[model samples]
Target: MPEPNKDEWEQIAKDYDEKWNYLHCIGALDSKHVQIRCPAGAGSLYYNYKGIYAIVLLALVAANYKFTLVDVGAYGKNSDGGTFERSEMGKRFESNKYAVPKDKELLPAMEIPYVIIADEAFPLKAYLMHPYSKAAITSDEEKVYNCRHSRARRTVENAFRILAGRWRIFLKPIETKPEIADLIVLASTCLHNMLRNTSTNISLFEGQIRMESEHIHGVANLEPIRRNFVREVAITRDKLKKYFVSDYGSASCPWQWHSIRKSRVAPRRVQYYLLNTRIRYNRPF
Candidate 1:
């Protein structure tokens, strides 16, 4: 896929700020496991924790539910964070090769870098953001930040959902060599973007959908960054967290407070309900 230029990146950031209320966010980053028949002589290399053989499809999705960048054919044995660290896209991000826009003022006094939002499975970076751990969250500010982060990050999840829904080939283990499976996934993602650009009714499939191997654990197992850089990234996140609750920030929705309160009172039920709501209506809590 072609890389989004600086102008395109600015447009994506604007769309994300308007639609998800997250500022300076260029895209949502995540991965999906594309199940495939065991490769010849591969042994457990393709086996995931779920005991299935597959390859990973690591994707960076735009605010409009279209893929912006994808790294396919990673062994399922690798975690999403690990796959990303080794990907060509990841290298470019680390080296500033993509020329992601310079830090700009989010408000009059608060400047922040353009970032791609991801889930906890990925490492925190200056150019990437993730939510605080649920157990570590204490303040209402953190709670609101997590809520908004999840909301914006859902774009990639929904992109995958729509892709699988429209292309049912992802419904089952693809019966082909890993190489061929990679080609199939690449082709499908390209076609998905093409169809989304031309189709007016693509939102019909945006409803709740599920896929296998959707969850992964061990965020601590991902590669570590320099201690100083980690501190810088944490400070960046704290700034954004503070901004989310400020008057200058986008106004918080009533449902966000309601959901956060429910989370403190009945965490399990709230989680269950949120999952169901996302599946049923494709709406964020």
Candidate 2:
């Protein structure tokens, strides 16, 4: 099957922006292990952390739970980030082969390149965003960024869960050759996209839906936009964080503050959340 073209990616980005309240987001990338019996002459090549023999199915899922791009047949032993780097999709992205559209604004005067969101397993780059590492997140800004990023990135996981739920075959180890398993995975994703396109009311897997906020959300939050000196000072590295804690954004996520206040257990992550909550609620303690 042919890969999605540039126009298709742009359309997907528009859809994602609408659904996730995040602008300039093209897709969400993730991977899953598809269990298979060990192949002959390959002892540990397929062994993964789950203590099973498998192949990795790396995918870029759109906001609507459709699989826009997929790469299969990587060794299960590889980390998700490594598997992604070795995949054809990754190579193309690195080379700019797809010619993804030029940088666009997530908020007025705040320009950012179209990007794909991934979990902490992937590296942060110009075109891809991964959450702040729990170890390095020092301030409320990073904490809010991590929470918002993870919230949007969750769609890819939901897409895979919905696919696996619909196709029971993936739940069990397939006793087939690696090559055949790859074809099956490809076909399954194709069918998934087909069904999503044809049906309007398909029930998604039961998952938590975060409350939608009015503020523009994205990784571009780190970049300060300068329209005038006044607006420039207002839009700093923590512009997104400021919105999340502002009157309009703060009222939309009271649950976050309540949860943060009740949990004092530390490892710094909790402290980060508490700081964010305190700042958002205008309560220092």
Candidate 3:
């Protein structure tokens, strides 16, 4: 397997900023459980909260629907965040081992660190952004912030959908040992990216993206295990939220307020429905 070099990471972030109107997004992170038969004598170690025996496939996807990095074969019994913290990449990131680019400003006098987006299952680290807790979103600014955050973060979801669609093996339980299943999953992911790169047929992803914009699916909110452990992360999120409501940010998408009003949903749950509505309020974002 190839490592994601600094050049590739920078290019992914640049494309995300240009194509998704989400600036400085290095990647979107998420995990999926590859269903599998219980391993011999494992004693439910592979069983997950979803009541299935499986192995976890954690991936960081680039803006172009390619896998930037992947770690497979964690027991499904572990939470996504737990699997991530134990993954080699995750440990390296925590220890600052990767050649992450220097921090850049989102706007003049507003230096914001580049970040990866994830759902509430993950910790809100200095380099990561997750939606605000559903119970604490009390202001319109937070709502808009959540909307924009989810919008930008949906790339990984789409990537997973495309991946599973292309490789139906993931849709069914693989009757193999855990170690072999890991290799299968890795090979399938590599083929997925190969197909994406060599093919120009994007109709499948395009249609899926359109449907995603029209339907707002409910995401289960998993409370963080640790609270008040990362105050700087929260402060950074606040700054981004405030920016979303400012004239400079709104200038990129002047129609955002209209879109928000039309959606008429909670801030954390509004991004999907707000996309592609025929209200004629279009802007770059």
Question: Which run of 10 residues does model 3 get worst, by summed lDDT?
Answer: 213-222
Q: Write the per-residue lDDT of candidate 2 for residues 42-139, one digit (tens) a residue.
A: 98999999999999999998888788889999999998879988999998998999868987554556555677888757755667766556655577
The lDDT, on a scale of 0 to 1, for candidate 2 is 0.72
Cα-based lDDT at residue 282, candidate 1: 79
Quantify all predictions' global Cα lDDT against the true fold: 0.81, 0.72, 0.79
Better lDDT candidate (2, 3): 3
RMSD per prediction, one decimal? Answer: 7.2, 9.0, 6.6
lDDT of 1: 0.81
Better of 1 and 3 by lDDT: 1
Give lDDT: candidate 1, residue 285: 61
lDDT score for residue 33 of model 3: 90
Please give me the total number of clashing residue pairs in predicted model 2.
Answer: 0
User: Model 1 Cα RMSD, Å?
Assistant: 7.2
TM-score of 1: 0.84
Candidate 2 Cα outliers beyond 4 Å, as residue runs: 106-109, 204-285
Residue 40's lDDT within candidate 2 is: 95
